[model samples]
Structure formats: structure tokens, C-alpha cells
Target: MALIDDTRAILGDLIAFPTVSRDSNLELIAYAADRLGAAGARVHIQTDETGHKANLVASLGPETGGGVVLSGHSDVVPVEDQDWSSDPFELREEKGQLFGRGTCDMKGFIAATMAMAPHLGDLDLSRPVHICLTHDEEVGCLGARRLVEEIAGWDEKPSLAIIGEPTEMRIVEGHKGCCEYTTVFTGLEGHGSRPELGVNAVEYAVRYVTRLMELREMLKGRAPAQSRFEPPWSTLQVGRLAGGVAHNVIPGHASVDWELRPVSDADHRFVCEAIAAYARDDLLPAMREISADADIVTHVIGEVSGLEPVDDNEARRIVSALTGANGADVVAFGTEAGLFQKLGMSVVVCGPGSIAQAHKPDEFIEISQLSACLDMLQGLAGKLSTAR
Candidate 1:
């Protein structure tokens, strides 16, 4: 009950930071670092080049290899254009749930982890418990990429990572990768009467989209036998397209925003390479004929790797035993788990709250969820204290 009260207090302070992906999360990082430092943990802050955002990695217990990492992101999506019953940044308790922007999406897990830090520090542990809180995960797992790179260079690296991504405290072993992109097309604008004199940028952009759809279907055929993912294949969608001024005039520029959720590496490679070839060999050459200055360019917004499942998973076994879970599952959403997996760590996603409440108006997490997360962390502490 004391841990629950401390968790609630910490969650309120975390919600007040307003660390949106587009804005700085330095304040939140500082607060977490201070709290963990007070509890006798060795804390390090990894900041981005801009110094506006940072990742927090703290080590408790013995400074040794084969530690367990508790990870979560510090950033939340924007609150603009959404209707809320109360201020999105203010933590509001209603019934048995705590309402706020990051409460469920997930500062809740971070709070629970932080609340038990003192207890973890007091234990006679044989292994370390690492706290990894990151920034800009909503944008593309940007912060975790840097964090894992830092972890890789260390002499004492963790062997397991538990990504707290609001999975109702269930153990999730796999999820799809998210790749976002934007492509721009440029051409010569001329009178609409004679179409041959000018290249139509919109038409060529449409062709690029068509190529994506074709590849989307191709990905379907390449799906592995009895895949667990819903639809059982990688998928693509064009999010936005904007171009042209009027019906009679030829538009000189156009752009399309698109994304892909890849289930595997082969599918990701196939879609990316095919799209590049289509643009280079088919679209650009033809567009340049009408105007030598014509061009097509693609910008990478983000490329988050997918968490693959494996039977030889220490993190999964440990979490399953602690939670007394009989089964594991895969989710459709992306998380920072895959980036940690790239470092050869046994990664598992087990945390409090529900994904359904994330990034919406009046988002909330049940108090029971935080209490459950506290129990898991406590169990983890006991296990680490005994793993000697």
C-alpha cells in the first residue's frame, strides 16, 4: 500500500512535465535522475545532439553483467485537436483510475519502477536492475536506438530487457516493426491545354503509390506459414497526399506520406528495394524527359525494428514465472523492445495499463494496474536478491 501511494505521487509529478515528442523532455529526465540518485542508484543521462531530450539509464545492485533492465519511454503524443474532460497534463483521479496524457501510454510503469527503487537498493542482490527511460518513442523509437548503442559499448551489459508498454501486465514476445516515409515529386508546370509540354507530378506520385499497393500484395504471398500476426503479413498504407492548385493548371510539386508495418526482415527489405527501383527506373526517367530539372526524393521519417520471438528467452521465462502466466502473446503495435533485442538481450514486454487508452482524450489507467506493476517489480527484486 505504501508503494502504491508512492507510485501515485510519482505519477502525478511525471504527468506535469508535458514531454511531448516535438518538445524537450529534459525536465522529466532530470526529475527521474534526481529521484533514482536519492535512492542510491548510479544514474546516467544520455542526451540527444540537440540537448533538448535525453534517456535515463540507472544501475542498482551489484555492478555486473547479466542484469535485468526495466525500460519505458518518457515522451507522449501531442494533445492538440483532442477533446478532454480536464487538462491533459494534470493528473486527475476518478473512481479507481488515474487520468492523464502519459498515465497509460506510459509514465505509469515508470512511476511504479521508480517507487520500488529504494527497496531494490536495500536488497543484497547478486545482479543489477537497470532503469532505462527514453524519449521520442512515439516519433520512432528514436531515443531507444541511442540508449541501446550506449549499452552495447559498456563493459557490463544487461542480458535481459523488459519494455513497459502498457500491455495490461501481460507478457508480449513479439510485435511488428514500423517504417514511416515521405516522398516528394517535382516537375515542370505548364498550360493544361498541352499536357505533353509539362510533366504532371501528381500523376507520377500516384504511380509510386500504386507500386506500394502492388508490393503490399507481394508481402502477403511472402508471409510465413501459420504466422501469428493478424492478417499474417506485412502491410503498407499511404497516409497523406497533397498537390496541384487547380483542375486546369499543371502542378509542379507533390508529396505522399506513407508507412509500413513489417513482420520480418525479408518483407521489409523487399518493400524498400522495390519501391526504390520503381522510383529510379520508372518514375524519374520519364519525368525528366518533359523537364530536365524534374526529380523524385524520399525522406525517412522513422524505421523501428520489430521484436522477434524466440524459445530461448530468459526474460520471458523469468517474467512468466513471476506473474504466474501460462501463455504469451504478440501485439500489433510497435515498441522499443526490438531495438534492445538487436543488442542480443532477451527482451519481453510486460507492463501495466491498456493500449486502448493511449493517445486519446480522457486517457486513464486503473490504480489496480499500478499496484500490479509494483508487485511484479517487488518480485523481481526478490529474484535478483536470490539469483546469486
Candidate 2:
């Protein structure tokens, strides 16, 4: 009960910082570092090239190998343009639920971890319990990459990682990988009425989008071998598009931002290669015919690779065992689990709220859900203690 009280206030403080992915999260990171340090964990910070965003890692228990690492992102999605009943940054308790922008999306998990730091320090363990928190997870799992690289250098890597990504406390073993790209098509511009005089970049972009749709259908038909996922297959869609100026001009520029979520690792590269081939052989040459300067440019924005837990992975097994779930399920939404998994640590996704509530206005996590998660976290600490 004390932990819950402490967690609620910590989450409120965290929510107030407004650590949006687009903004620097150093304030939040520093707060976490200070807390963990005071609780007697050796804290380390990993910063991006710009030194703006950061990922913080800390450890309790023994400094040796083979303990659990609890991980979560410190960043929240932007609250701008979202309709909310109250100030999105302020945490509100209403009818046994905590309402805030990142309360469900993830600051809640981070709060739980911080609150547990004291208990973890009190426990005597055979192996170290590491805490890994990162920024830019809502953007693309970028900060986790830096954190993973740091973990790799350690003499003793954690045996498993639990990424608390608001999965309603279910053990999640897999999810689709997401890759986003911005494609720009440049063509010759001329008078709109002089049809043959210039290349219409917008028209060419339409062709590219149509091609993308066809490819999407092709991928949709190839069912993934797993039944855990909802669609059980890969998917693609165009998220944003921009082009042209006025009705009177043949616009020379068009750009479409699109993304693909592949069911597996092999599927991700296959889809990327296919898109590149289509750009090279189909769209580029035709656009070039109108003007030598015509070109199609593809820029990768961010990617969250599909997580594939190793057979009987400790992370997956332990979370499933603790939650009384027989098997782990896959989710359609991406998480930071894949990045942690790539660090030679078996990873599982399990956390407090439903993904359904994430990113929506009036987002909340039930008090019961928070209570359940704390119970599980305490249970996990007990498991680690006994194993030692």
C-alpha cells in the first residue's frame, strides 16, 4: 500500500515533466538517475549524438550476471491537438483510475519501477537487478539502441528483460516490427495547361502509392505462421502525404510517408528490398524521362523490429509463470522489447494497462490494474531473491 502511494506521486511528478519524444527528456532522465542513485543503484546515462535525449540504466542487488532487468521508456507521445477533459500533463485520479497523457502509455510503468527500487535494494540477491529506462521509444526505440549497446559491454549481461509496455499485465512474447519511410518524388514543373511540357510529380506519387497498395495486398495474403497475432500477417499503409501547390501549376514535388509492419525478421528485409526495387525499376525511370533531374528518394525514419523470444526464454517463461498464463501472446503494436532482446537478453512485454487506452484522450489505468502490477512486480522480486 505504501508502494502504491509512492508510485502514484512519482507517476504524477513524471507526467508533469512532459517528456515528449520530440523534446529532450533529460529532465526526466536526471530525475530517475537521482532516485536510483539515492536508492543505491549504480546509474549510467546514455545520450544521443545531439546530447539532448538520454537513456538511463541502473542496477541493484549483486553486480554480477543473471538477474532480471526491468525496462521502460521515459518519453511520452505529444499531447498537442489531442482533446482531453483536463490538462494532459497533470495526473488526475477519478473513480479509481489515473488519468494523464502517459499514465497508460508508459510513465506508469516507469513509476512502478522507481517505487520498487527501495524494495529491490533491500532484497539480497545472487544476481543484479538492473533498471533500464530510455527516451525516444514512442518515436522509434532509438534510445534503447544506445542502452543496448552499453549493456553489451558489460561483463555480465542480464539473463532476461521485462519491458513494461502497458499490455494489461499479460506476458507478450511477440509483436510486428515497424519500419517507416518517407518517399519523395521530384519532377519537372511547368505550366499546368501545357500538359506535355512538364512532369506532374503528384501523378507519379499516385503511381507509387498504388504500387505500395498492391504490395500490401501481396503481403497480406502471405499469412504468418503464428496464430497469436490478430491479423496473423504483415501489413503496410501510407500514413502521411504531401504534394504540390496550386491548381494552376504542375507541382515538381510530392512526398508520401509510409510504413510496413512485418510479422518476422525475414519479412522486414524482404519488404524493404521489394520497395527499393520498385522505386528503381518502375517509378524512377519513367519520372526521369520527363526530366533528368527527376528522382525518388526514400528515407528511413524509424523501425521497431518484431520480437522473437528464444525457445523457453527465461524472461518469457518467468513472466508467463508468474502471471499464471500458459503461453505468451503477440501484439500488433510495437514495443522496446526487440531492442532489449537484441542485447543478448531474453525479453518479455508485461505491464499495467491495456494498449487500447494508450494515446487516447482521457486515457487511464484502473487502480485495480496498478495494484495487480505492483503485486506482480513484488512477486518477481521474490522469485529473484529465492533464485539467489
Candidate 3:
């Protein structure tokens, strides 16, 4: 079959699984593993704690050293409440665009790579080529973190990793880190009639949230003079908050779900430490004055480190040579690239489609983009076929 047809067939199979982040992605993993295994590649599967999800690492050619890793996530975001013209799990094409959940955000790249698998064995390669599909990346890069730890223990590691996130086929060198957290406040409740008798948890929660906003501004002021990020600063925001039962009573419990996107690890550490200090020395002390039992607790739910630009990056150079681009770009979104970079591999983000189309109603990827990606991968295969 032609590359386009093969890619579409594989992409359709991937979309049919409905591997949402909330659900198990073993089905998708199994399909990928089967295809890679049939292609004469050595496939390794790593199961997560629940054993319901897994990551697959498949390699073609010799496994000694100096290989390129094409990595993408198997799981996608939820399609709930999104109004689509057709079934989100069914790949539909109209006017040269393929519509489906995960089509743009990911699976397209995976499909293209799988389409190349049948031809890999025919190449006269000096180095190996690896295809790595991970789970739960939409949640917090969970599977990639585990996979990276496993890779760290390997005797042989890839020279470069290219994360197939939606980058419109451009080379992306950097992205900010994301940290998600929740703060819960517990206080004494009483009737609204006695204003001074009760410690209102909702009120304290608001105060804490207000402090977070102030810190957000402070972070804005701390942006590095030469920062390349679009906003040129860290960002903090509260996404969800709830607590009160009745207007006539003082609520005893409240919670806030918030997140931080930092350009640097120092910024991340600063904001986290500042928040903890505020809760301990400023907010919690005031809350406890009303009632000794009053307490504020913060828990970090997720963290994906930012990808910082590095000097002499082989992944960037290879992508630039393939795409014929002069420079790389930066994105506001996070990816598993940083985790791979932490494992001492040169990492770059380059893939088909636009991120603007990702995680939205009627998400889609242009057929032209997929064709371009196939061409790029073919170029990579040609490069790998010759001895370096």
C-alpha cells in the first residue's frame, strides 16, 4: 500500500480505540505493538502501576547505540460535551482534512511512523530507529516519566528524541513547564447570625486565592530580560474553586484547583516555595487565630518540566536539516520532550498539524500536513540508511 493509504488505515484504527486519558490505553498499545512486531522490530512493553495502561518501545536495526526515537502519546483528551458533526472516534475526511479526536494532537504522527515500519527492514542502516508510544501524556506526562526512568537504566540509549506533538511540522526547541495543585481549607462552621463566632473556610479560601493572584503579578515582574517565551514570564491561575453550602451559614470546607506554567525551574521553585511560605506564615496563622482546628493544605497533583533550549542540540539540527528551516520556535504548551531531555538525550518537538486544532470541537489534521510529515520521515530514513 502507498504511504498515505497506510497512514490513514492505521490512524483510523488508532481513533477507533477511544483511548481517553480517563480510560485505559492498553488496546491502542496492543495494536501498535502488533504492527511494530510484525515489521521485524523488537518491541518492549512497560506496564503502569495499574497494569491497565502501557508504553511501547520498538526498535529497528541494531540496538547498540546512536538511534533516533520518534515518540508520541497514545492517550487523548476527553471528547465529552464537544459538539461534533460525526462520531469523534471515527476518522472522517472532508476537503482534505481528517476529522477525529487525537488526529491533530497526536495519532497522525504515530500513524505515519507505523506506515514507515514496513520499509524500515529494507534500509541499509548504520544506526537504529526507535518508535516509542506512551500513555497518559494528556494527564501529566505520567507514562513518559516512567519510561524515561526505565530508559535511564538501559545500557544503550538513543542519541536523540523527537516528540510528535502538534507543531505544524516546525521544529520546536522549548516549552514551559506545567504544575497543577489543589488547596483545601478546613475551618469551624456556624450560623451566619454570629459573624465573629465562626471561622469561614470560604472566606479564607478566597484570601488564599487572592494571594495567589498577587504572586502571579510578582512572577510577571520577575521575567528574565532575555526570555524567549511569548509571555516572557511565569503564569499562575485558579481553574476551579468551590466550598459554600448555604448563604445563611458559614461553610466549613473549601478547595481551589490551580496551576502554574513556569519558563524556568527556578521560577517553578520560587512560586511553589512562596506559596508554601504564605500558607504557613501568613494565611494559616490568620485562619488558626479564629479556630485552632482551622487548617490549609496544598497538594501537588501533576508536574511536567519545561524544555529549555540547549547549545549544540543534535535533535534541532537534524530536524532543521530535514524541514529546511533556519531556526526553531517555542510553544506555550508542555510535552514529554523535557522528560526525555532529562535523560540526557537531545530532544525536539516536531510533528504534523496545528495545536490550535487540538482538544477542540471537530478537531482535524490537514492531509497536506500528513504528506509533508511522511516526506520528512522518509528523509530521516534515508539519512539513517547511510553510515555516519
Task: Compose the digit string of candidate 3's lDDT tens values, residues 1-388.
Answer: 8899999999999999999999999989888999999998899999999989999999998877778899999999999899999999999999999999999889999999999987887786778888999999989999998999998888888889999898999999999999999999998899999958888889888988998899999998999888899899999999999998998999999999999999888989998898889889987887788899999998878899889898789999988999998899999889999898888789999999999999998999999999989998988988888643
Estimate the TM-score for candidate 3. 0.93
Clashing pairs in 2: none
The per-prediction CA RMSD against the true structure, in angstroms, equals 1.6, 2.3, 2.1
Worst 10 residues of 2 by lDDT: 220-229
Query: What is candidate 2's lDDT per residue for 341-388, written digit by digit as tens?
Result: 777678899999989999888888887777788888888888878555
TM-scores of all predicted structures = 0.96, 0.91, 0.93
Report the backbone clash tally of model 3.
0
Please state the error at residue 136 of candidate 2 in Å: 1.8
- Model 2 has how many clashing residue pairs? 0
Cα lDDT tens digits for candidate 1, 1-388: 5999999999999999999999999999999999999999999999899989999988898889998999999999999999999999999999999999999889999999999999998888888999999999999989999998889999988999999999999999999999999999998898899888999999999999999999988888988887899878998999999999989888899999999999998888999999999999999999998789999999999999999888899999999988888789999999999999999999999999999999999999999999889888988888888643
Ordered from best to worst lDDT, the candidate numbers read 1, 3, 2
Query: Which segments of candidate 2 are over 4 A away from where they belong?
Result: 193-197, 386-388
lDDT of 1: 0.93
- Which residue ranges in model 3 land beyond 4 Å of their true spot? 193-197, 286-293
Quantify how close model 3 is to the true structure by its C-alpha RMSD in Å.
Answer: 2.1
